[model samples]
Target chain A: MKIKTLNLALAASMAWGTAASAQTEIEWWHAFTGRLGELLAAQVEKFNESQSDYRVVASHKGNYSEALNAGIAAFRAGEQPHLLQVFEVGTATMMSATGAVKPVYEVMEESGLEFDPEAYIPAVTGYYTNSDGQMLSFPYNSSTQVLYVNRDKLEEAGIDPDVDLSIWENWDEVLTQLKDAGVTCPYTTSWQSWVHLESFSAYHDVPFATNANGFEGLDTELVFNGDIQVKHIDQLGEWAQEGKFIYNGRRNEAGANFRAGDCALFTESSAGYAGVKAEADFDFDIRHLPYWDAVDAAPQNTIIGGASVWIMEGHTDEEYTAVAAFLNFLSSPEVQAQWHQDTGYLPITNAAGKLTEEQGFYDENPGTEIAGLQMTRNEPTDNSKGLRLGGFDQIRTIIDEELEGVWSGQKSAQVALDSAVERGNQLLRRFEQANR
Target chain B: MEKRVIFKGWMLPALLLMPQIVITAIFFFYPAGQAIWQSMFVPDPFGLKTQFVGLGNFEYLLNDPYYRASFLTTAIFSTLVTVVSMGVALYLAILADRLIKGSGTYRTLLIWPYAVAPAVAGVLWMFMFNTRVGVVSWYLGLLGYDWNHVLNEAEAMGLVVAASSWGRISYNFLFFLAGLQAIPRSVIEAAAIDGAKFWTRFRTIVWPLLSPVTFFLMVVNVVYAFFETFGVIHTITSGGPQQATTILVYKVYSDGFVGQDLGSSAAQSVILLFVVGVLTVIQFKFIERRVHY
Candidate 1:
């Protein structure tokens, strides 16, 4: 009996020792937490289970900024992960990383995976593509701004629940209706500088910056202080002063207010769907963002939000091949469709969209298709594509500060915008000089 | 033979200190040296390409209005927070010292704020001061004031400084309390027999004896005020209401990570290191001399 027990113990020890050394771990650093984090973990687990070749390990470094910083620091230490998720604002910075990254298209091609760049939605793919229309990063979770309406709140305010807050021909009509309905918090938005200034410019088919919003080159200049921007901000400021439009604190604190049904209308990213679905007890609908009637081409496609998975350099070829396989797995029609349905992010591939439509997701979940419709309805011009400016996050901060001044009645819209332009231009010049 | 024996003993002690010295050399001294080296040159994002610019980055920073503004703001923020925190902490320590009962409980309760991490501290203060749903805003509304830090410059500064000091005062209090307790009861008794009141007793014996602790706390508070409040400022205001709350460390983070101007950010970091170094040297030279210890 003692000999049998010793034999069993020896067998267990040998099994444990070999199991510890078996898995070839691939580090996937991302900027997701909460519900998104869970979904991401499930995806990693599914991928890990599907294959025995490599184990993909996902770590939440921090928010977008912190994750990017961690990736950069790790890269400098020669310890970068196989895959790093970078937000849209870091596109230009990532592009300028000379040899710190291996382009996704190149990786896919080198790995001999049956890859097609055209398989991705043009608008979604273009943001992370090179000038020649080659994808540089995998579009992991792409979202665009949409108007979220509290149907219950609207009905309570004696406004028609079916009223087309979806298509505001002009700001004048939006203000009139909101005032008539006595909406104390008619409209509030998260990422004001994003939805209002950057995406707003893109949606209006207006230039936000010179040099095709910095896509053409690094020497981009701030032009968001143009007439259209000034007029919109001034109108919003007026609404703010009248209590029709509430300016929540910077960041997404307004998300809670909207989810809690305090606000009648919210301008936020489509990825906010998960939070709204979970938190909102009242009926709500997502709609296309409202546009100004005066613009010749209103509702020109909105720019992408969320983030992309950039493959950092310095990993071995085996790691790259593993990354390519993981990305391809992520981009498969079934996986892409499920990811889009699970998170409010857009389907990156055409097949995923068709799959979603076939699944009756759009029909069952109204307004889920609005983002795709808005993005596809208009062919992207230079102004509508996206901004790729260096120091853009800092520039956004500057815009936020200046716009807050206008919102608080401290500075006029024109003055605030002009100061923002001047200050933002200085940052551009510094960026240009540094990168030169 | 005695000298040789002493030298042999010192050799072992030096050997014992080698690991720490090696770590400091590898981590701290090496990176600091590299930062200084990089500040003189322009390095690419990957840190591969380098071109010697020789003070070009410094010259640019000097000429740049935003950088200058950030520096001035940092100085003002550091000085104000340090002075205010030290004053408040000293007062609290004195009050706690005078209490004959439950002094330990008071001390423990006072130091509790320091136990919270900076990130949580930032979020907690942000929750309290946020305009839309903040409890403080509710109170302000009751008082008939439209209190929104996001739009008001003064309010933004006040909110950041208050949050920073609130988190920082506990450590200062702990130091001050310890210093207060260490004072001999005989001195206070002597002052009492001589008809000295509480204020007079504090002004003479207690104040001089606590000077060492006060000086140490001042240096610590200055450093904390300068570098440690970045998380609070980042969460609360993000240096908003037109860059009113942007201090040095926050600027470094913005310029380095968010802004992606690694060279400029490194340059700013070097300048901060220099500023902190100067302040530290002056504190040691001037204030340390006045310390009773």
Candidate 2:
């Protein structure tokens, strides 16, 4: 009798739940937290309120790496969500997982929605596009490496706050000045591999890997240990020994030191604006990532570093329609402009970039447009387009390990980067073998 | 003579053991078999294609310098964790056992740290040792010593071992306290009357008598350090500073889940399983003889 009543109650609840909403529910597993999470949630809420056809339920699924792993596990279990937010490093993995994901271009075509590939920023979209000229994922939150400086720290160190920090020659002098002024941590950085290696190679117009960074084929080799890259790291190693630059962890753990007003300068993602604005009390400014002035073709455009939204497989046709509609909504000029202005992420669409400019955002905020200017300043060569090597996440770890050896004075920069290239190439070959 | 109560029929005994047998088969044997099967093949991330390469993953792991170095790292890490945690717990247990008053409060206080999860303990220790903002490191900085575990291999290994051993000390403390309490007061008093000082009595009588518990804890703690301490390592060092702290279990996690190299991870797990099997066998066959119950 008790079991019968329990079943009756459960049946009633199920009926009531279905009766409550006729709208189709779309699940989006994202890797956003804190303020960015709130904004993403607001976007979903606004989309849901704007139309009654679909209710997008966006949930935070830890950080980028964790969210991708969750998606993989869920897909293996045949319970994947409708959409997943994957970091740029996982782009190759997701693209190779042909059975686990539905391409965004296909989803757009099937939804009968007004979708145009030309609308997205070229440098941002190029990273996720296949050789066949099809976009694999929706470029949701694109960011480029940017230098963040504490203006107060600069002034306190008796340096001109208006000095040009765009070039590495000037930046090195500034680092030395700050150190000479008794600054303990004159400079620090976050995402060392991303900023120093990937973005550095792009900004200098050097290939980070062969096969145009794996766009041509999967059989690519890591060639980031070239002369320019080695010289850059060797200089950074010298700076470390001289107390001009401080070595932080592999990831963004040094963001804390920068925000806590301990470091004078930081090289981090442009998306670091949100955290700087929220947690920092000192005056800070975002600038273009520095380039070595010795190189002839310096100051080439930097690549994107943020995540994209992937449509996972095993969802219904109706859900795919909703996903396409939501992606369109997210890329709308107004929404994209708002996201760019709010989070310091790049406006994935050219229209959104124009929209942000027309609203007088750059004029009002001095450093807000640096990321945009840096990315769009030059036509991206094959070298500056960005990398798409498989197992890049592990390769980055290997690079981090090698770089740590250099920073600790245990190994020379050349030797360390050579080993990194060798290790990374092994991973690349293994990836090529498996994916084939 | 021991009293034996036999079941009337084989059906009764079999029925009683069915639940355990079924659970073991489902949880343990099934996963072990799957891991072994998967180790022989490399699959793409989506499981779209699979390439069979029997023992190829193991061969690669053996040839890879990093994987071989990880074996040494794991040996060093487990030995340090077990020895440090057990030694500290035994010392504390002996101290707490000698106190005639407020022994309950002492034991309770000692065991409370066990309630904290390994991950939480790792985070706690990481915060305290953070180079930039950590209080302990800041104090160390004031003393003219730089504590940079991010680039310092020895420091990184030390920090992780300390964090991994922190919560385990509580568990070992609980067992040691119980074993000390279970010892008869008359034996200890008789030792003391025989002109044996506290140290001598503890060395001769208490230490030998406590061998059974010590032996049990050594095996348990070794296993814990091998498998369960991945949480601490994952939270603390993340097998960093040039793979200085990459234990075998941590490597397995990073390779499989983070790197998405399933076949290699499976091969690593099989090797880890064999190692633990050998350890358990050696402990039971040889060490058990020395342990008096």
Residue range with the least summed lDDT across 10 consecutive positions in model 1 chain B: B1-10
Steric clash count of candidate 1: 0
**B116-193: candidate 1 lDDT, tens digit per residue:** 877778889888877777899889899998887877788888888888888688989989888988999998998899
* Cα-based lDDT at residue A290, candidate 2: 87
lDDT measured at residue A273 in model 2 versus the true structure, 0 to 100: 84
Best by TM-score: 2
- Weakest ten-residue segment in model 1 chain A by summed lDDT: A166-175
For model 1, residues A49-124, the per-residue Cα lDDT tens digits are 9998878989999999999889988898888989999998888878888789889999998888788777889999
Kindly report which residue stretches of model 1 are placed more than 4 angstroms away from their true locations once superposed: A1-26, A51-55, A166-183, A315-319, A433-436, B1-28, B284-293
Model 2, A60-144: lDDT tens per residue? 9999988998998888878799999999999999988887889999999999999999998888898889877799998899999
Candidate 2 CAPRI grade: medium
